[model samples]
Target chain A: MIEVEGVERRYDGVAVLSEVTLSLPKGGLTAIIGPNGAGKSTLLSVMGRLQKPDAGRVTLEGMHLAQAPGRAVAKKLAMLRQDNHTAARLTVRDLVAFGRYPHCRGNPGPEDQAQIDRALAILGLEPLADRFLDQLSGGQRQRAHIAMVLAQDTGCILLDEPLNNLDISHAVRIITLVREAAQALGKTVVVVLHDINMAAAHCDRIVVMKGGRILRHGTPAELMQADFLSAVYETPISVHELAGRLVAVY
Target chain B: MSPEIRARQITHRMALLALLALLAAAAFLLLNARGSWDFLLPFRGRKLAALAVVAVAIALSTVVFQTVTQNRILTPAIMGFDALYVLIQTGLVFGLGAGRVSALDARLVFGLELGAMVVFALLLFRWMFGPAARNLHLLMLVGIVLGTLFRSIAGFLQRIIDPDSFTVLQDRLFASFNAVDPGLLTLSALIVAGLALILWRLVPELDVLALGREAAVGLGVPQERLVLGLLVIVTLLVALSTALVGPVTFLGLLVANLAYLLLPTGRHAVLLPAAALIALITLIGGQALLERVLHYDTALAVVVEFAGGLVFILLVIRGVAR
Candidate 1:
């Protein structure tokens, strides 16, 4: 379980997140839904230990996030940000192999190779593994990066806007993959998403944020109401049930 | 490519580097052996040793600096290291008379230059801007400002010094491989070797570091401390080489980029040696051509700078600045 207590983050006297407390239970998909400037990415970064909170504590399975050794924490949690610009001429396989660095420290053994192959297979990247990142299309590159994080084999995965730059087909595939990983592997997945309908359809729990604070948190059925989303987003949203799944139309 | 195929390619490149380094060393030794066996051997041997030391210092420093900055076009000299050395020389000549400055201990001068360069680098790194400002443009901008300041100060001091003393300082400022000081060379070799050992121990970390700061940190590398250590190493290497042979700014840029083009892998193990070999070939070959073809009448730095400058322009035009 990941627990955040009174987490506060401010930048140059402007509060990005204020007194945000939340708990993410293990073995499920939790979608953090919010409008722009809602501190979704900031909260994800704080929970992943990428950024420190000004006034709060984060604990991951009984260990303080800040105090734990970086390698130790990396072994248990993996994060993929929105933008990954690199200067090195690395192929898809090369980038994914780096995911095992926390375990093998660049000297990958047979076991590491096996895990890498499994990740490539899962992401449908075996054929494109030899292609350089710059040569791939945006959706392919996004899937490649996701494969890298999945190769890390961490129990808790945090992804900030994983659906960006992906086409509809790739986006649906990725959402299904994340859901499958959470259900089959018993992993806790936290993702920040802009598409409210996708979040409602795939996420077990949705947390709504506005103006740097969590305004509401509940199951999809409760949070997907038209009135709740319209108030949260400041736009008219119609909720409809299509084949037992909630769809939000704005 | 398959892993086996890539490994084979790396091994092949390593073999080629070893062969080139050996050939360069052999040619250097043969060219320096001209007079009586006893007298000429030791005398020219010292000069050869000095050349080898400078080559290694410049090559290693350039490769490491590029890695840390994640830039192919940047070198230690870009940070005004050579300008600082020239400024120090001018200050010495301007403060004391020529006789006193000449009489000062060579080792003492080397130590002072090394210390000043390291301190300057630490200060610059400590004041680094935010992540968005960490691009090559910012580095180049700050470097140009500092370099202009150093050059202007040195020029102003040079104008005030006596003509004879100014001549002495001027001779010291231009890069020439033929007139190396043996004492300074020995000290520099020791410093270079020590730093080389430290870098070898940190090779694994450096491989990760080449991926840039955020990715390195995400992979569990202590980014701040490692970058600081690398800056210090780069400072020592740059200071030692600049003190020995003035400054050859574009030489590092040429060799490092050439290594990148020739070597297919991103692994530092291959990239470092490939760069070192290119430097060795350029220095030894250029020195031979100057001695034999040009009758040892001109500075080797001029030819190297000419070739390196061309390569620099070509690389920029080719849009490989990344």
Candidate 2:
């Protein structure tokens, strides 16, 4: 399980994540849905060890993340952040191969290559494997980054807005892959999602954050009430039941 | 595509280029001399060694700096290292009399200057690049302000110093093809070789760092410690090169970009050597042209800067940088 307790992160004396505490059991897809500035991304960043909390502690399976070795945290939890920029011109394959860094350090063996190939195949990036990242379209680039994270093959994956710049087709493909990562591979997937309906439809659990605080956390059916979501979002959100799944409409 | 195959191709091309650049630098050094071969050989040989030292220092530091900062257009000069160097030289002359400055042991003074530079950089940056430091732009801004301040102080000191002292200071302030110290060359080579060995172990991490800070951290590269180590090395390198031959502001920018354009792979293993070779080629070739063609009408630095400035403008306009 991944746990965050009293995690507070501040920037310039303003708290971005204010004493937030949450826990995620192993082998589940938990989508954190929040409006802008709700601290969802900040929370994920803290848990992933991309940034440390000003106060509070985060742990994975009873191991203190901050105290653990860098490679240890990396192996247990992988994070793919939004701003994926590269100074060097790297091909898709090279980028994915880097995902295996924590596993092989720098020296790669056949196992690392196999993992990279699996990630590429799962993302339908085999054809674009040779292309430079700059040569790819926006959607293709998004998929390439996602492939890199998946190639990491960690027990828990934390992605912040992984669907950015992707079209509906690619978006749906990625959502499906994320679901498989949880169900088939039994990896804990905590994704900061923007689209509430997608979160309700696909995720096993939903966390609603507002004003740097968790407003609600429950199963989709439990938290998908129209009035609760509307207050959490401050925009009128209508919730409906469709095909035995809760659909959030805004 | 098989990245291994692509890397192999780039390595092969870089190897060929490296061979050509070495031969060209050698030929430029060994070619015609009007005086005795024995005297001329050593004379040109010292200059060659000086150029090699400066070349390796600038090329290696710029590449590593760019990797850590993830900014291709930025060189060590931008960090105010050379400006600090000028400040140290000016202050030395201003404090100790010009007669004393010239009388001091050159090697000892060079070592002191290098030490002061490295320490200044460490003190300036260590507190700023702390764990909470998120913005690299902050570092650049501080660098710009510090560089200007150092230059201003140096300028003020120069104006007050005696003319003879100013003349003595000028030798330290400007890069001179005719003025590399033979005593320092052997020491500089050993340092560069030592740094090369240390940097070799860092090659893989260097490539990962080019992916930006968060990515590097996520890859378990110990980003902060690694960056600090690299910054110290970069400072030492800039300090050595600037103190050894004065500063060549644009040579690093030119060589690094040329390496990026010429080498196919992003691996630092290939990029660093390729850039160093390219630097050697440019320095040696430009010196050869300055001597044989222009007849020393102007400083080689001026000509190289003019070309490098053009390349810089072209690169910015093309918007190919990160």
DockQ of 1: 0.60
Fnat across every predicted model, in order: 0.42, 0.69
Off by over 4 Å in 2: B1-9, B131-134, B307-322
Candidate 1's C-alpha runs over 4 A off are B1-3, B129-140, B179-183, B309-322
Candidate 2 lDDT at A154 equals 93
The per-residue C-alpha lDDT of model 2 at residue A55 equals 98
Model 1, position A169, has a per-residue lDDT of 84
Q: Each candidate's chain B TM-score? A: 0.89, 0.91
- Residue A201 of model 2 has an lDDT of 83
How well is each residue in A1-250 modelled by candidate 1, as lDDT tens digits? 9999999999877999999999988889999999999999999988988788999989989889888887788899888887777777778998898888888888899999999999999889999998888889888888888988988899999999999999888899899999999999899999999999899989899999988899988899999899988998899999998989889888
Which CAPRI category fits model 2? Answer: medium
Worst 10 residues of 2 chain B by lDDT: B313-322
Per-residue lDDT tens digits for candidate 1, residues B275-316, read: 877887777767766765677778888767776667657866
TM-score for all models, in order of appearance? 0.93, 0.94
Tens-digit lDDT track of model 2 for B119-182: 8889866866766564778888988999999999999999999898898888667787677677
